[model samples]
Target: MPIRIDRFENGPNDVLDLKAGTQPHIVLTFLATNNEQAFTQTEIHEATDIPRGSVGVVLSRLEDRGLVRHHGRYWAIGDDERLASYAAQQAASSASTTDDYYGESDE
Candidate 1:
């Protein structure tokens, strides 16, 4: 894996990166996109293709941070305002990375 050293010489106003492809991030994204619904650990594991144990652990961690909510066996994205900004930044980063990789075409 290549290390990306982000230098913010202009002071700290940059968007907070959720570190793409991480288990927690993946689980959060899945719940966010399906905000209208909730799922159990098994369902989330199947949907996100993450290990069942990992899914449970990640969900617990996210809940501790108030990023997700649960009722019995079901889990859903929490109403954290920070999530809005995080999602926006993540989307922007993904787009920029994709554009950089594919590059612009004159045609």
Candidate 2:
């Protein structure tokens, strides 16, 4: 999902707010891609193209928002099994569509 930027101007003051930058989406993508494995900040940075410094901030925000949780030095998709299931279903649907469009089959 692309982030939507909202801009506001009030009496000569301009502010721009981003709707959850690539961080949350990236983290979810990484987790889904990794088969529910826990990932470290370094790994998230490498996989998601997010900076090391920013990963912590994003993870913290996600934690606060009840999206992800930290265990030691690694992060995992929090107790939200439904979200993980949904992501997996979406991924599978996308892959199936791609295969159908390309006339490819695992069988």
Candidate 3:
């Protein structure tokens, strides 16, 4: 059950597919994992393997599309509850599959 990025499509403004240096993947992964948490550019740089210079551009693209918000020093996910809920459900399903296959639970 891998996390699939749905908002990103192979279109004109698909930053995920564009050559955004080496940070797009990092930003995507970070957003997918911590959509519920607010983070700063510095925090994103430290947490990810992305270059420091590319953080601003990547964040800007995400922000422009109403995907992320930059408030004070925190960059939070925008109003995309469906994506968050989908991720959570995928995680739960994966966990259940692992438990069932590993024979770790009785029922």
Error of 1 at 33 (Å): 0.6
Reference-based lDDT, each prediction: 0.79, 0.70, 0.68
Question: 23-64 in candidate 3: lDDT tens per residue?
Answer: 654575566567678888888989886778988888888777
lDDT (tens digit, per residue) of candidate 1 on 1-107? 54445645544553333577988889988777676789999999999999988888888888877899999999988878877566566566666876767768789
Alpha carbon deviation, residue 76, candidate 2 (Å): 1.1
TM-score order of candidates, best first? Answer: 2, 1, 3
Clashing pairs in 2: none
Residue 21 of model 2 has an lDDT of 56
Ranking by lDDT: 1, 2, 3
Q: At residue 14, give the lDDT of candidate 2.
A: 26
Indicate whether candidate 1 or candidate 3 has the larger lDDT.
1
Model 1 TM-score relative to the real fold: 0.63
Q: What is the C-alpha RMSD of each candidate to the true structure, in Å?
A: 9.3, 6.5, 8.6
Which regions of candidate 1 deviate over 4 angstroms? 1-17, 84-107
